[model samples]
Target: MLALSQGASRSAISRSNKARPDYRGSAFIADIHQNMSVTERGHFMQTKVMSTLNKKGVKAMGIRQVLPFKVLAADKYRAIRNNDSLFDLYGVLIGSCQYLTGIISARRQDELVSLKSSGNLSPNLNPFEHENIEYNLIFKLKKSGNGGKISSNKIIERPIAASIAKIIWRLEAFNEAARSQGLVKGKTLDLFNNLDARMCTLTKTSVKSFNAHLDSICDYFETPLVKMSNGELRRQYLRQHQLRRFFALLFFWQKRFQGLEALRWMLGHTDMSHLYHYISSNEVGDILNGVKATVIVQGVLNKDGELEKLKSIGELKATLAKKYNAGAVIIDDLESVIDLADDDDITAPHIDQLKAEANLESNLEELLKTGEISLEPNFFKVTDENGQVRETFNLAFQVKTV
Candidate 1:
């Protein structure tokens, strides 16, 4: 069990980062980290999404239970056979979460923007993008979302996209159930009349009333279902958004095993300082247990492991040589290979892109395949001519080349 620092207290944080939406593609893995400050199990979060401090200043304590990812996956599979409203609702939630994480309201816009700029975002395909599946899906979801009157300006922070998508998708299922019960009569403000607008508006309603609505669906749609009062219904169902956030924090820990720097990149943050709340001492125990080590002579010590702009290919090659502990570096171009020595300089503006690929197209096969990267603050110590400690850096942050 991991732990969160004192920063997890609600008094310190103004908003809760409790939602994980699936926005798969270039949004990729860190999409889970977007706007979410995930913490270990011990982290304190408010029970209610919006709550004022009590008389003694104690926020109600309740860790909202969530359907585990595996369970959701199974529910989705079952939905195909059952075609039940509950099952359908579960399926939409799970399906929409495959690549989304942060705020439910903003996901459609991200997809919309990404779709409009796919050419710029992904020109050379990644291993998973053999035929532009992500590009196509973004366009499709954008079209579906536009049909619902979603606004570009209405954005939310750190709530799970899946939960929101579930709510959006669940309404259709609810309306269908109500129709079956002949309850979709006039003047009820049909929740589906303007789906996106209703979605934004519905968040302002009481969770108990919203839950009662779900119970009404259960009574209307399922054949042998039990009914409950509003309070009973609200208490029975876990606070859905909190559960979504719990899944996200778990994802944050899971990704930490893949190297913190990589996780930071995927989240699209300029720096990784914000994620510090999730780290406890030695959380990334022993990453380079079996990696070969050699004397490094020429790499820049990157404390943050951020890809910084280098002046020339000569500088990049020097960094790579020291990082890999090799005298010479080679670039495999299929038909032929180019050898880059420490002193090799480049005049071509395009060729300088080797700096970018240094981190992306790196020799991290072992960690990438295993997802067990260790985070060490001081990877190696640098010595001057007199054997005095000059600089201390971590091996996990070493820059690499293609």
Candidate 2:
């Protein structure tokens, strides 16, 4: 029995390697490192989407849970507002700024800490602006190769909603007041920092301390338990990088408006594939199902409570016939078809399968409108799918002169 179990394990490993040829040799380690931005299980799984869907792993905090942590931070701030210790109040408010800025910018902690007030902050033009006001923050990406030159830095501007910006501004005002009282030294001009005996930059130790504060807040609120990697369970705590992941998730929802290219730029990623590694792939399945449900509810059902002849209906029938090895399957009710699909008994049509066929010209035009895809001249030397230089063709006069 032991030998058989060992053989079964070897067979499973062999099959896994065969299915994912990328994991065949030394490339397996590289792939794991590349996918580390996602859920921990994603290192071994075929795709980040599958790793997220597989619930029996180290789960990260969702947006719903993380949003409440902001509230908890607010409550802590309120509790300490009347305290005599300016340091305590200042620390709490600074932590709140970190949390808010972390989620909004989706930037690394070091980049976030390096934010300057002069070039970065552009307050709203209207003085009467309140909740609707937005402030633009310019982030300067750090480059070791550029010798700390501002001209060589990549600048990314992000507009932050006033509701959150107000908190950051409040912290800035408070820091100024403390500085006037000879509390903090004005050495580092970074937007966010802590005031010890002197003004100091926040480090990795400070992040860990902030996480402990989150853990304590969860204890006070009596939040539910979260599973630890070692099989022990504890209350959920927020991490700086977790905010980056949540921000990526938020960006995915607004992809139709904000688009993927903007997200890639904001995340400081040169490659779309790397940007995708940052996003939670499990949301793709949920969004696809949502599109399916919307089609069924609105497109398939009629105003008179009757089924209409949809292109999806014909497709569903053909899918069912081939799936069951039966001839001429009839779909009388889409509700029944949806139920069968839920039970994994039948393959039903979804929104994606109902869309028109793709054409290069139309796709390129749509992508250009969304600012997601662009064309380059021969000097740029863009390669084809096979990584070879594509031949340039002149179509200005409707002539294929390569």
Candidate 3:
């Protein structure tokens, strides 16, 4: 019986080896029926084993509890759809946020949305506050556009013409007051104070008006002075000044009579031939020629006599040049004649005699009747060192009306 059992066991081992070569090498499987069961188990384990356990010589066997194939497929489809809709929805939200707050930025939008979601929205916020946020966002975008930095100078510059106009207007008021009321004691101070106060108020009103006017002008020109750089605004202002100067000159010359009908009659139109005669016969000529020469001579004497007289002439020439808008001219040389005179007795008594004759000139009323009341200054010219004659002219008048 022992011989028979040994034969059976050997026969089983031999049969297991023939069926599975790996089974013979392992002590775990011996009996043919147990081996057959183990063989079936190994086949199951091999099919279900994870890749990690296969490498370690250990076979895995258990139910994986995997999610349903349909559920996983549905989740994938939803993820892809969400991705497609996200960009468009984000764009809409960003646009709405920008419209409401007047600001544009992803980070700012995110912050705002976060705030809203967090229930931190404030009802006390005013339009200005909302505007500030918008302004800040715009500023950041502008900075980003310009490489994330802005110059300090560019940020601080503004229109200067309005300020300049206010200053000029104040000066004109002061001058007008001084001219209307003669140089009385303490009157200048009083006039200046009154004008200063009036001008201060006027300046504010004028500036506001000017700003509106400038806006209109800009609109007409299709330009914005406020948005323009400082240099550009300055150039525009200079051009404006040129235009104003031209118009002011025209108005000053045209309104000679200053609303006086009688004065207008006396100063006839340019077309009238008798105008020159009226001016030449006026008593104004006498007062001007008499006192003017004396004043000139005395003023020159107070400065160094001959040299001073030359200086005075030069100044007069400059004044004429400006008035006529002409190039400067050098008249006859006075140096030689001035040198011949004695320093101790430099007074020209003949000048006094000329003054007396000037005083006898006809009155304004008589000159007006004759149509000879010329109030405009005249021009003259003389040869220079190189025999080149130059001409300069002016039309300035200072008349004291009675």
Candidate 4:
């Protein structure tokens, strides 16, 4: 089944995105059950599986059953996924480097939509540098967290580092396109000085225009992006707000820091309740599974007698859960999942390639003068007082190559 929404593209949600649409949002979930009946392969079968929902009637996370198959066959799926550029931001284009980086985040579109100048992110300069590294994608925000009632600016981690460079790259790409249109510009970085009403990008993409692309996405998945039910509408709202990214980030930090304090600090939420909606018991099993894997891989095989490092799997799960107190990970729940996951030995990837030596090359001073990048010489090892001879980068501009 193919579940989707109408007038609810990621860019379509109002300036104040009301929902968090992810791969698991209601419309997409519903479409999976209520698939394209009139396909070339004869009519389809669908079961209107529904679940209990919140007061405002958001889509319930619990669907009856999910069965995914090749809707277009392997070849067709590949065709769509590969040549998605024609569909641009509608089809697999959502996975494009530009779309992903331009909207570097799903939750903070509003804050990015408000960027008026480059001054918000001052340059980090170094006279002699051998690396391109930036600490953060600093930006001024109106009620940071893209209007979570936050009073100050925000600095969140990038998707996979090089976020600043990627942003500059996209900005340059947009400028190159805009320049061809005779839209008037000295430099796009200099011209995109303000976020106008209904706009979502420095390139001036408006919400009204952005929502129009919803049809293409539905058409590709052979589904309709309409709010026929409260669950459907709620899911649409969530997707617009990019709640998936918000909750995903929270959950990611939850796994990393394994604590509520880390979550509160990163999100800047007033208290724990501000994020209760994103919390759930489903993750308890995930936490346990992770610990279970660690037990089998590291605890059991690494060193059976190192009590401090090799803890009983149960204790490991408990400690991780207690630290990340966002969800309840009772032993009973974990036990049920334990029986299902077949644990076995796994291999660690050989870092033979990582051990290979490589050279660094870039016009550091040129990039600096143009404010096109940042430099962090401290990230690499210099053979001498002169910044040369480095195998890899290790700094905040997030270069973890080695």
Which candidate number has the best TM-score?
2
Model 1 ranges off by over 4 Å: 1-132, 135-235, 238-240, 252-267, 274-402
What TM-score quantifies how close candidate 3 is to the native fold?
0.15
Residues 1-402, model 4: lDDT tens digits: 011111111233222222223435554455443333322111111222112223232223222222222345555433443332221222223223223433344334454544433333324332124146553444443342223455445444433245544444444455444445443223443312222211222234334433333323433444423322222321121233343244443443343323444444444456655543223222222232232222232222234334234324345345434543624433333333333322412122112211110000112122222333222212234464585564333211211111
Each prediction's RMSD to truth: 26.3, 23.1, 39.7, 20.8
Q: Provide the lowest-lDDT 10-residue window in model 2.
A: 393-402
What ranges in model 2 sit over 4 Å off?
1-91, 117-119, 124-133, 142-152, 195-223, 227-233, 254-262, 268-402
Q: State the C-alpha lDDT per candidate.
A: 0.31, 0.42, 0.29, 0.32
lDDT-based ranking, best first? 2, 4, 1, 3
- In terms of TM-score, how similar is model 1 to the real structure? 0.22
Model 3 segments more than 4 A misplaced: 1-168, 172-269, 287-402
Ranked by TM-score from best down, the candidates are 2, 4, 1, 3
Clashing pairs in 3: 277-372, 278-371, 278-372, 278-373, 279-372, 279-373, 279-374
Please give the lDDT score at residue 387 for candidate 2: 89
